[model samples]
Structures are given as structure tokens and as C-alpha cells.
Target chain A: MKKLLDDPAQAVTDSLRGFGLAHADQISVHTEPNFVTRAGGTPAGQVAVISGGGSGHEPLHAGFVGAGMLDAAVPGEVFTSPTPDQVLAAVQAADAGAGVLLIVKNYTGDVLNFETAAELAEAEGIEVASVLVNDDVAVEDSLYTAGRRGVAGTLVVEKVAGAAAARGASLAEVAALAERVVAGVRSMGVALTACTVPHVGRPSFDLADDEVEIGIGIHGEPGRQRVQAAGASDITRRLVDSVLDDIDLAAGARVLLFVNGMGGTPASELYVVYGVARQMLADQGVEVVRSLVGSYVTSLEMQGVSVTVAVLDDELLELWDAPVRTPALTW
Target chain B: MKKLLDDPAQAVTDSLRGFGLAHADQISVHTEPNFVTRAGGTPAGQVAVISGGGSGHEPLHAGFVGAGMLDAAVPGEVFTSPTPDQVLAAVQAADAGAGVLLIVKNYTGDVLNFETAAELAEAEGIEVASVLVNDDVAVEDSLYTAGRRGVAGTLVVEKVAGAAAARGASLAEVAALAERVVAGVRSMGVALTACTVPHVGRPSFDLADDEVEIGIGIHGEPGRQRVQAAGASDITRRLVDSVLDDIDLAAGARVLLFVNGMGGTPASELYVVYGVARQMLADQGVEVVRSLVGSYVTSLEMQGVSVTVAVLDDELLELWDAPVRTPALTW
Candidate 1:
């Protein structure tokens, strides 16, 4: 594989440095502990939005910290959630007296560490709230497991609640908005090939050229099933149908449609999927009020796409339409 | 070549259908004519924001259609611009009684088609204005055979101007703001590997495993030169410095930085780039006001990153901070 870098081991460090230098105004080196946050000093009475997970998903937590998104995003190594101590520091750094909201995906390690930090923050009078994001419809819940893993849908919650926070909506309002976004959104994905984690240095999954895994998670977790590769129209229909089946979207209810590239699918292909997706909905008498198609949320160079839809109401629409300026998301 | 598809020809069409089905509420299908617009119908007398280009840049023209962004977008095939007719129709669809502003990249086909449509709109008595985005510093001259192609910086123009438009700013105001965004923004890129342009069944360029191409265009265009593959930090610094040198960024001036993935790169490396990038900028006394790091704009799976910095003033910053609701971008 051809790449522009010296040592693979140093690749992550190199990228972080570049991120800091590029955004020296909004972000800086929080070295003693590590993370990226607004360089212009934290504001008081603001609910600190602290979220972190793996490093491979750029513009997620870190790229989101700005006017209307996240206050601080603690990016861990690729596909690895930050440790408890790191989460704790991020929470502390983002704290501006109004308390912080910990946005943690429902992954095992991420949830556990963040929940513990929430408790610790509460003990320290920081007052923290967390609404676990489990928008992935492909996952099955086991009583022993940490529930559904958060996927691309976290972006919806972050943007919605982040907007609410930016509007000076109370913490309750922000938390409530986040929950509504979580409740309304559903996502499902498929993978044509397993992506090799950077450190692992090998293919994550060994699928044959002719096979494609349906309903796969972003982290290379097992998919719902493997199937023969189908046409874009067929695949697009299946993915959207699966997600809609997971949630009973009212026939006339407005929705915000998102066809996310799982890192590798190109925009052209995504547009093709969008074409089919638009037709399928019309065939079903559903009226899409709004739409989003792109790599807004992504997996690391995974060759596939995920379909996400959020049932929208007036309030949700307002929040969705709100202005925001962040590194990953703009406008 | 582990793509999950029966054939490549139907990729774009199928994807669009799937996209429609998923967000059936907010958007409707444009069968006879391709293109999706707002559900409530384009308001009369509202200045419509219209943008389109080639297809692979997903979530760009299409996803960014809503209250604060684009009114409608026309999508073409991958890496190929839409026909003059398609663009004209979208302009018609998006045009409320007020008129329309065409936000076009500096690509030859896009500019030509959009320019033609502007004439057609004037014939229809519909007011039209345009801002040519030529933010790529790599492609220096505004006058060239292949002039500076628009890159991720287009998103900023869209967002900033979209905000101004949403705030009831006049067509002149919106057009002027967009030009300012285009003027303030500058981007440069480097590619590590050539991308496969599906139809060609070959790579756009060939780079030795240890070599990197700097100042490359998103559409697999050649760059300034090729050098040995250096660390991500080194490459990012060079990319940043290259842009800085071309534009004399005032010391202590606040700027919005963007580090974008050229399709195939992983975020793990992006963070490393950010870290070093932050330190370097601080050392230069350049303040990174706001930053966006992600795959906002991308080539078809090219392994590299492009750096974009938009010089920000108070008004521009406010406009940047304004809320926008589009499929690809949300605040």
C-alpha cells in the first residue's frame, strides 16, 4: 500500500501535530494530559461537550469543537477509545462552571470509561449528563453487553444537542434534544472489504472479491450477514429498507436523510445510491423533507456506505437548520 | 477491487434512489428531471442558492440543500460534470421569484455549463450572480489551461454565503460574501497514491511507494512535484507552509484551518497531522481560530490530505458561526 508517511507507528502522532498547527486559533496542544480544545479560553455557563473515541474517524470529536458543536473532543488512537484518565481530563478541561455533557458512543470501553468519568465529575461538582448513542440498527442487544454500539448517527445527536447548547438552551434542553435525535435516527451499514487497522497491518476481514457483508458496524464488527454482491440499486434499496424497517417512520413525517460513505465509497457512488434511495421512498409514499448525502460520518476507508434517516419535527428541523462553525461540520 | 456491485454503470443512479428512500420526508423524487429540492416548495422571491459539478464529491451539492445552504443541486456522474441542460433545470427549480446565485467551482466544464445557465436564466428574466471558487493555491494562476480547481474550500463559501442569504441578505450581499469567502480561502494538496476513475479501470497517476505528490488537485490532477514520502507531520507542515508562503497571512490574525482527507486517508493519521500542525502554527504566531478536518471534499479514494485556511474577520467569523441546515452540512 502506498502512503505518504515515514513510520506507520508514528503516523498518528504526525497527524495530530498537523491538526494543531493548522487550527492554531481554535485548538492547541493540551500536552500535560493530551487533547484538542478551543484555544480562545473556555466560556462560563456553557455546558462542556466532551466526546472521544477512536482516531480513525476524523472531524468527529476534535473537529467538532467550535461555535455550535463540541467544546472538546478527546480522540484516542485509531478505533480505540480514550482511557478513563484521559476522559476525565477532557471533562475537566471542557468544564466552564455550567457542568459538562459527556457524549459517549455505546461501545463497551468508551461507555464504561465515560460513565465512570461522569460519576467522578459529579463527585467533583462538575455535574455531567450523558445520553448514550445507539443509532446502529444492525446490532442486537444482549443483556450482558453494553447495548447497541453508536455509529454514524452520533453526528445527528451531536449537531442537534450541540446547537441547543450553543443557543444557551439549558443542559436539560440540550440533553433532551440529544435524546430526541437518538430516538428518531437509525443507521445500518455494509462492508465490501474489511479495513485493516493501522497498527494491525493486515486486512481486518478476509472477504472474497465477490462477497459483501451487509449490516456491518464501522469497527469491522461482524455484519448481519454476508451476501453476493448486488447492483447499486438493489443494495441501496436493501440498506434503506432495513433501516426504515428498524424504525416505523410515519408516512407523512418529514425526515433528514443521510447516505454516509463508510470511508471508501466515493461521492459519485453515494449520489447513485441517493438516486435509488429517493425513488424507493417515493414508491413508498414517503416524503423526504430534508436530505444529506456524503461522508458526514464515516469509517476508516471501509469500502461501503451506511444509510441513516431521522424523523424530523419542527423543533428538530430548527435545530438541524441552525448555524454552526466547527472543524468537521460547517454552515 | 473488493467493491460489492454487480456493475459499475448503474452505481450513481442506484445510489440516488436509495438516498431518496431513506429521507422520503424532507425531499421528493425528481424523475423526469434529476435533482431534489425542499419539500415546502421553493419560496417565491427567495434568492435561490444553486451549485453542482461532477458526482464523486458526495454530500456537496445535494446534501447541502436546505434552509441555510443550497436551494437545490444537480449531480452528474463520478468525476464528470453535469450537462448544460441538467444545470439549467436545477437553476430553474431552485429559482424562487427573487433570482439565483450559482456557486461554481473553477472546473472548466462546471464553469462553462453554469455560465451558460446564467445566460439562459437571464433570458427567462431571472436574476443571476456567480462566484468562481479557485481556492487551490497549488494551481496558482486564475488564468491557466487547467486553472485552480475548487476543493473543500467551496463548503466554506457555501456555508458563509448561505448564512448571509438566510439572514435575508440581498443577492448582492450573498454574492459579495461568497466572493469574499473565495478570496479569503486558499488550499493546497498532496497525493500519495493515484485513484481509480472507475470507467478508466486504471490509476490517475503512479507514485513510487516512498514518494509523495504535493499540491495535487482533487480529481487526480498532477501536482507541483514529487518527493520522498516523509512523515505525516513533515508532509502536513510543508502543505501548511506552502499555503502560508503564497498568501502573506498577517501575524496574530485569526484563521479557520481545514485539513481534509483525499478520499483514502484514515483519521488516525489526520490527528497526528493536526498535533504537529498546531505546534507549528503557534510557533509562527498564527492563530488558528476555527478548524475543520474531515472528508468535506474528496477525490475518488486518493490517499492524501489537503490543507485549507480561510482568513477570518469579525463579520466573516459571525457568518461562519451562523446556523445552516443542509444535507451534508448542519449546525
Candidate 2:
């Protein structure tokens, strides 16, 4: 309830205006359609990469738009999916002669809307491909998702796929690379506190001071279990175990590790979690090839952390290391 | 206090272990003296830049250690100043016979400890120069200091000064550039709620359900005043006005605007503040040459925002745009 905002209804639109101004050198905003496209128009023969979901997850889709990442990002209201029309506008704005790729999270509404948008774009003779990111290992099914929740790994997908697109990959090649990245990655999260949607004016869930939710989704949906709060090491072990269980990796497998913060968690704690998780992976004889630690996908003010591990091959590692100039994931 | 940590006493050291492991390619950790130094040592003739302070304001000193930034960082216990021995160790590790520059915040404890360290280093024949950043316009003095508290502007100092040092500036030159950056910058912040230090296990201060602390310090130190909670625009106006008053700017002045989140606030809200801040600056006819909107300097889980504006000339602007590969501020 203590959020900084003028009106809850205006939060998404107003924030986008701010994003446009702050990153004017790298992005342009389409006010009417509520999408952000690359400031410089797409190259004539490079595949356009577009991604979006709800707005509360900062720097996910919007902040990732730039030279080596997303071409366009269409954000909806906080925790609400964008309409098909909005997604179509983003596609049209980002499309050059090459093609367009829609990077959709596995959320039911997001999948439906983005599919509709892809169909609309195809009808207009714009070649398009689509991929779903369902890397969250938290639950088999969730309140708003059909199969699995797309959590922090969406960022991994966007980064690798964006790099591929930037390298002039065709629509089919970019979508295939995105799917491979999705299949190779798994993520799990835990929340010590629930987040309040600005419009709701209350936390989405209630928990006692000493309780914690393990395997939680980004939207405060119930995870696999809620238990008494544990220390950073124990919590990290649980999330890492969950992710490791879902992924197939041999001993000595090199992987990329991502430790994502759930908004309110400080970087110090995230590092603590990272230390524990890295130790855990080392114990399992898996080599961490690369690591990213920070708030990439966040649930608004939820205090927690998510651990993601993406099995990395030489090609995938090369793509991950490829220069990215997005606001959040530049390197 | 609900923090993600195994032991409150070991938080700082344990977190650094993770930082070292995660950024092993770029940094190396010295556990005994408790400092992080660049894994790839400083260039033979490059002046080494080092910074440090309390542990909780993460990604400040530690995350800024790498190429084009701090050569070393010494972290103390949470909200506590590091010992002179620790700072001296960092200075020694980073010193490559070219000299060393210590960037200290304006907190009394930090200044005292860093000064002691400088004397220690000089006695060891390492030429040392120190610069104090006190750019907070919140008050003339605060709970922990005799003068203005160094807040978000410290990042600007580290960035520009570190760039100068990377360019092989002499110790005197780096120190002078850091001082100039401090003089050119002013910042103000507001806290929506008090933060709980893990060891303290309680909120630092109390506020009513509908109250806010204006001009708040990063350590939750008392600021100018508290008042009934206001909308983001009104609050942004108050903070922007305070910073604007303390700095000299003509109508056509070009400045770099930084809107930082104090840990728990979501990026959406930070952008709201940024949008308002950018508009206010434009209304005053000040052109924003560059803008950084994120949680660069943060209080631990305190919900709030801080605004900083640094007057920029061609030299400072060029340095600001120089490539930086720190863990946090990479571009």
C-alpha cells in the first residue's frame, strides 16, 4: 500500500512514458498501442524479437529491448496479459523484411493473446514464429497457468534468443534456439513475503512472520508447499534441488547459473543464496560456466529469490556471451 | 528481522564468498582482511581506485570492483565502518606502484577509517590520495555525520573517478576528478517505511500507516521532516526541488539524472518517479544529457526512492559514457 504512484490504473502507462524518456536513446514508445519498439527501426534483414507478459516483472520484456535483445515489448496492466491487438501492433512496429518471433511466457492468457497476434500478423503476410517459455519447475499447473509457470528463466530465454535474432538468424532458427534454451533451463523460487498488486491495495496472500512459501511462482501463486521460514542455505538448497530434479545434467556438465531477486530482496542476500547454490551445484559435480545475479524478473516487492540453471553447450554459451545492450542484462 | 541469511554475524563474509565465486573471472577475494580486488590486477601504470563502507548497501563498493571501476573494495559489518587494516589491505592489493586513490563517503566512521588506512598505505610507500563524497542535499548534517551524508551520488563518483583512473590518470588527477563530481552532484530521498537491520531485528524508526520520511538517509537516518504520505508526483516534486535548490544550474544546463530505488520498491514505481523527475527537470528547462533509473545505491529493504542530478561537461560526459564492466554498472 505504500507504493510510489499517482493512480493504480495509470501505473503501467505512466511508467512506460518514464521508460521511454529515460531510455530515449535506445527505445521509442507507441502510446496508442502500449508497446515499446527499438528506437532505431529494425534492420532490413534481421529477425525481430518481441516478448511480453504482465507489467509487474520489471526489466523482463521492456528493459530487454535494445541492440542485442528484444525488438519490441508490449506490456499489459500489472499481472494482466496484453490484448492481441496490442501484441499485433508490437509485431508490426518491430517487423522488417526478415520476420517476427513472439517470445511468450506459458501463462494461459499470454499464450492465447500472443497466438492471436501471431495469427493476425500471418494474415497480413508477415512471417512469424512463436515459442513458449515454461521453465518454472515450481508447479505442474498453477492458478493462471495451464502446464507450468514461466518464471525467471524467461529472462534466460529472451537473452539467448535475442542474441540469436541480433545475429541475423531467421525466424525459424531464432524460434528453435529459443525452444532449445527453454528446454535446457529450469527455475524455482521461494517467497518470504507476498506482494500487493497496485490496484488490489493488499498482499495477494497472507503468511505468518515465521512462514515461507517454497517453490513459489512470480505472481504469489501457491507454490509446492508452505513451511516455516528457514535460513538462506536451507532455502537455497530447496530451490536448487527442485531445479536440479527437473533438469538432466551429467556430472561435470557446464551450466549457466542465474540468481534472480524477487524485488524486495537485497543483492547481499541474493549473493548469499548464490554462494549456497553454487556450493550445492559443485557438490553435485556440475560446473557453473557463467553466473548472473540480480533482480531480472521481479514480483512487485515480494521478498524472495529464484535460482535458474541453464545447461550450456558451446553454441548456447557463445550466444549467452554475445554482447547484449539491454537496460538490465548488458555485458 | 526477516532476512535471507544463515547467520547474521557471517552475512558480510558469506555474501562476499558468493560475489567472488560469481564474478571470479573479474574479481578475487581476500578472506582474511575482507576485501575484493580485481582478479586481473591493476595495469602497471594505472592509478588504482578503491572504495568501501558498511556491508548492506550492496553493489555499491563490491559490485563496482572490476575493469573500469574500483580496483578493490573493503566491506565492513552491516551499517558499520570497516577497520583501517581492512582498507589498507585493499589499498595494498590494488597498488601496482602507480599510487592509489581512496574514495570515501562522508559518514564520520567511514572517513575516519579510510583516513587511517591512507596513512597506513602512505607509510608503506604507496602514494595515496583521498576524496570525500558528500552530495546529499537532505540536510547540512545528519545522525551519523558532521556534514551532508554521501548517498546515491557516491556511485557517480566511483564511476567517473574509476574511469579517470582507468584512463591512467595520476592519483592526484583521479582524486581531483572525484571531488569535482561530488561538487557537481546533489541528491535527496524519501522513505516509505523504515528498514530492519538483521542484527538489530527491529525497524530503525517508526512511521504511521499513512506517513513518510522525506529527505531520508540511506542508513535510515533522520532527514528534513516527516509528513502524511503523498502521491508519487508530490513526493517526487519535494525531492527534486530540494536537490535543485542545492545545485547551481542555468536554464539550458545539461545534467545526468539518476532515480534510485531503496531496495524494496519495484522498478515500475522507480520509473514513475523518474518520469516525474525528468518532466520536472524539463519544466525547469534543464536538458537531461543522460539518465540512469534503477537501484544502484540502496538501503536494505527500505521502500523509497532517491533522485540525483549531476551537472556534466564534455569531459565528465565522455568519462560517464566510457565502457564499464563492473558486476552492477556494466555497459
Candidate 3:
């Protein structure tokens, strides 16, 4: 696959430069590299929430940085986890006197690297806590891999804890909030098209035009299964059904619904999904108190969508009600 | 062009359903037809901020509904403007006591329709104000074709104004703040691939693998001109330079920079662009106080990036700092 680039390795740096040029008022690039933060300010006495991973998902780590969300975000190359050193640097930069918490999606490399970075930060006297978001209900109780591969559900945990941290919640409180969000949330996705990582220059996988893969991880990694393309309403049901079954967001529970595009599906389709999903939830006696429909979290350019449900409580709802300003999801 | 769908007309509604399902908590279908909001319990009196356009851009109009941002967002079919009635209904739902402000991107159809809606709202005794965002430097500043097409910069205006409104700033205040963001922001983009609108089922334009369309619009419209595809470093420079020259974010001035993906470029490339932009701004002694990088707004699946700069002031900064919890950007 041909792509516009000087060098594949330099792609991330170049992309960050473009990002800096466009949103320089809300964020700043750290001198220590790969670390970005809200312009000129650090969270004070609040848990400095930090998260990072492979670079492909735009706005996830970086766009999430601001007052109500992540204090700092570090991005590695496409599909490659941020190095331990990068994670350590982000933690150091975001750390106020309060401490820093790393929200790691449950990917092996990310977990290992962030854990290593936490140790390094601890060595430097920076109080660091780690919260793993393993909310993807798609990855079954596996014999091999970890439980579920975290996909779009990371955004929910990030926002919930980010809101708490923004409210001056302590590191422990923020960590607990994050863990609760992870526990309450469940996500599942399908991809209609395989993404072409610029460096690779080809589709990650090959499927006929009518086929879509279910349980797709963001990176186009081989998913749990492939299925014939179905209608959007049907797809939403399937995704939500899996998530509902996984988390048992029982009848009458207050839920936060997120119909997230895996990057490619348009808002037009997402909106349609919303109507069907609302009806489905209502039929199940689940009350959706709030909903987010869009590409807040995404897989590259995969033409599919994911369903994320967060069983909410008063506290979680309050946290959710807190304001946030990120580049992607702003209120 | 190949796509995963049964029929073209069903794409938008179908997608909306899926979107609603995902973010069911903070959003819900505006049962009165084509609008969406945070699941339930509309926070009344907040200056109802409604933004909409064609459907391709996800997490833009709809994903941005919650406490601090838009009260409702309506989506049209793929690349098709929402009808006036849809806008009117959204305005009605959002108008509590304070009134409603329309944040319209400068596309001709959107402007005309939103303008009509504003009139309808005023007739209904709901105070209404509107700020048209025309920040795309790529479009020729001719008396021709209504003003310059509002590109990704619309997001900035919506966020600042939405935040102001969420804080109980009146319609006038929100409108004025929207203008401030509009005045300070400028964006220019280049696309490597011609996006295909779903209904159209064909590429909007033909761009060879090594060709780039500079000055692209948000609707997959052809850019000002077609040129050979260049490296990310070079493309970043061109787009950023266009924005910088269009608006003099003078040396030593702190500005918010936004590098928006036209919906296709990988975040890896975005980071690289961010780095180049950082150094470029430094070279001119322009201090980037805040930065936003990602596909905050998009033009379907075009491999392109737009650079938007919002020159910040004290008031804009506070407005930017206000708390907001929307599906797309929360803080």
C-alpha cells in the first residue's frame, strides 16, 4: 500500500507536529518527547490522569488531555505501545503534588510498559497508581489471552475518572472511580473493512465485500469470528446483546450508552443505531440516562461500530455530569 | 465504490441507531425526529446549542451533547444538509428559558437551513442567535459561492460557545463567544483520497495514489487544487503555513492549534505533523500554549489533515476552561 510519508518511522512525530499546530492553545508538547498536556497548567492536588498506547487511534490519548480528562497522553507508533520511558515521562510531567494514575487498556504490551513506567515513577518519588480498563466483553473467558480486549470502553473509564480527578478527587478516589467504570462498562465491536496501516500498505485482513468481522480489536487483529454483513439495526442489537450478556446490565438499571464508530462508520448510520438501541434498551427495562453516539473512540478506518454500555449509579452519573473539554468529545 | 450496506437511503438512520446504542447513557434519541441528546433529563436554561450538517462527520454535532456542549445535534443523510424542520425541532427541545444559539458551519445549505430555523425559533418566542463559522482558508474568499466553507474550525467555535452557554452565559454571550472563536480560527486541509459519500456510491473525486488535493472541504468536496502527494512533513508544513499566514498568530503569541484529520490519515502521521508544527511555531517564536490533534471534525474517509488555530484571549480562555460533558468532547 502506498502512503504519503517521508519515512514510516517518522510518521508519528510528523502527525504530532500537525496536532500541535492546530490545537496549541489547549495542549503543549513536553520537552521530554511524546508527552502532551493541557496548555501551561498541571493538575494540582488532583490525580494526574495519564494514558497512552499505540498511535493509530487519534484523540484517544492526546485528544483526551485537558481539564476534565487526562492530564497527559503519550503516543507510540502505529499499533505499538508507548515505551516505558515515554510513559514515565508523561507521568512525571502530569504529576502534581497529588500523584499520577495511568489508565491502561488491557493490552499486554501497554500493561507491561505502563507497569514498568509506574515503577520508574515510584523510584523517582512520584506516586503512581495503575487502573487497567478491560471492558471489551468480546474477549471471552479465554484459555490463552487475557479476558477481554479493551476497545472503545477505555473512553468511558477515562471520562468518568477524568471527571473525578477534575473535581479534586484524590488519587485513590480517582483510581477507584476508574476501576468502577471499568467494572461497570462493557464493549464489543465488528469491522466491515480491514484498515491499512500506512506502513504496511495493505489491508490487515481480506474479507469479501459483504463480510464483516465480529469482535474486532482496534488494530484489525484477527477477531473472534466473521459474519455476513447485516443491517445497522441488527448489528447494533448484536453488539449490545453481547455487552448486555457480558455485564448483565440488568433490567431497570440506569445505563450510559455509547454507539462508537470503529473509525469509518458515519454519524448518519450512528444516529440510526441510536434509535434502535434506545428501543432495545427500553424493551429490556434498562433506562439509558445518557448516550454518546459518534467516533469518540475508534479503530483505524475500519467500517464498523461498537456498543458500549456503562451501568451507572448516582456517583457515576454525577461524575459523568462533570464538564470536560477535549478535542474529540467536548461539552 | 464498495461498501457494507443493503441500501443507500437507509445508511443515515441505520448509523444513528448504532450510535445511540453505544452512548446510551449520556445521549438519547430526540423522539421528535432527527435530533439527539444526553440520554435524558435535559438541563434546561442552558443556551441550547444546536449544530448539524451532512452525516459523514461523526462525534461532531451529535457526539457533543451533554451538560456543557450542545443540547442537541441533528444529522442529515451522507453529506446532505439537515432539513429546516429538523433544526427547528432541535432548537425547540434545547430551548429551556435561556433561548437557543445556532452554531453553523458556513456551508451554503447548512447556513440557509439553520438561518430559517433561527427565524422559526424567534417566531416561537425563543430568543435565538447564530454565529457562522467561516474559518477555512482553503476556500477562496470570493463574493462567489456564499462565504468560505467552514471546515474543522467549526468545532472550536462550537466548543467555546457551548462551554460559555453551559456556564449559563446568555444567548448573546454565547453568540459573541462563538464569533470570537470564529475570528481567531483558520483552517486549511489537503486530501490524499477522494471520499465517497454513501448515497452517491462513488468517489467524490479521482485522486491517484501519489496525488493530494490541497484545500479540501469537510464534505469530501474537491480541494482548491490537486498536486502530487508529498511527505507528511511537507504536507504538514503546507497546511500549517496556510493557516498561520491566514491568521497571524504572531511571534510570542500563545495560540490553540488543532490538527484535524479529514477522517482518514492515521494518528501516527498526525503526531509527526504535530512535531513539525511545534518546531515550526517555535521557529517563528510563536508559542503554542495549547494544542489539539485528531479528527475533531472530518470529511468522511479522506486521508487528509487540516490545521486550525484559535488565537486565545483571557475571555476565550475562561470559556475554553469551562466544564463540559458531551459525547464527543467532555471536560
Candidate with the greatest TM-score versus the true structure: 2
lDDT for each residue of candidate 1 in A1-331, tens digit (9 for 90 to 100): 4444457665556666666665666666475456778777456787777778877666577777777778888877777878777788888888888777778788887888788878887888888889888888886852213668788888888888777887787777788888888898898888876776666777777888778888888778887789888777678777888887888866776787777777777666766666667767777777777766666566666778888888778999898878767656666
Window of ten residues with lowest summed lDDT in model 2 chain B: B1-10
C-alpha RMSD of each candidate structure in angstroms? 5.5, 1.0, 5.3
TM-score of the candidate numbered 2? 0.99
Q: Which number leads on lDDT? A: 2
Tens digits of per-residue lDDT for model 2, B1-331: 6778999889888899999999999889898879999988888889999999998888888899988988999999888999999999999889988899898889999999999999988998999999888989988878889899998999999989889988888888888888889889999999998888888889999988899999999999999999889899999999999989888899999999999999989999999999999999999999999999998888888899999999888989988989899889898
For each of the candidates, what fraction of the native contacts does it recover? 0.64, 0.75, 0.55
Candidate 1: tens digits of C-alpha lDDT, residues B127-243: 999999988888653332266778888988888877787777789988999998888888888888778766666787788977889888878777788988877667888888878
For candidate 1, the per-residue lDDT at A125 reads: 86
Ten residues in a row with the worst lDDT in model 3 chain B? B138-147
Residue-wise lDDT of candidate 3 within B1-331, one digit each (tens)?
A: 4443446777766666556665666778754367886566456656778788877887677877877777788887777789999999888777778888888887778888898888988898989888888898887643223778887888878778778887788888889889988888888888777778877878887878777888888776656778777676688788888887888666778777777777766655665667776778788888776666666687777777788778888888777767766655655
lDDT of 1 at A144: 19
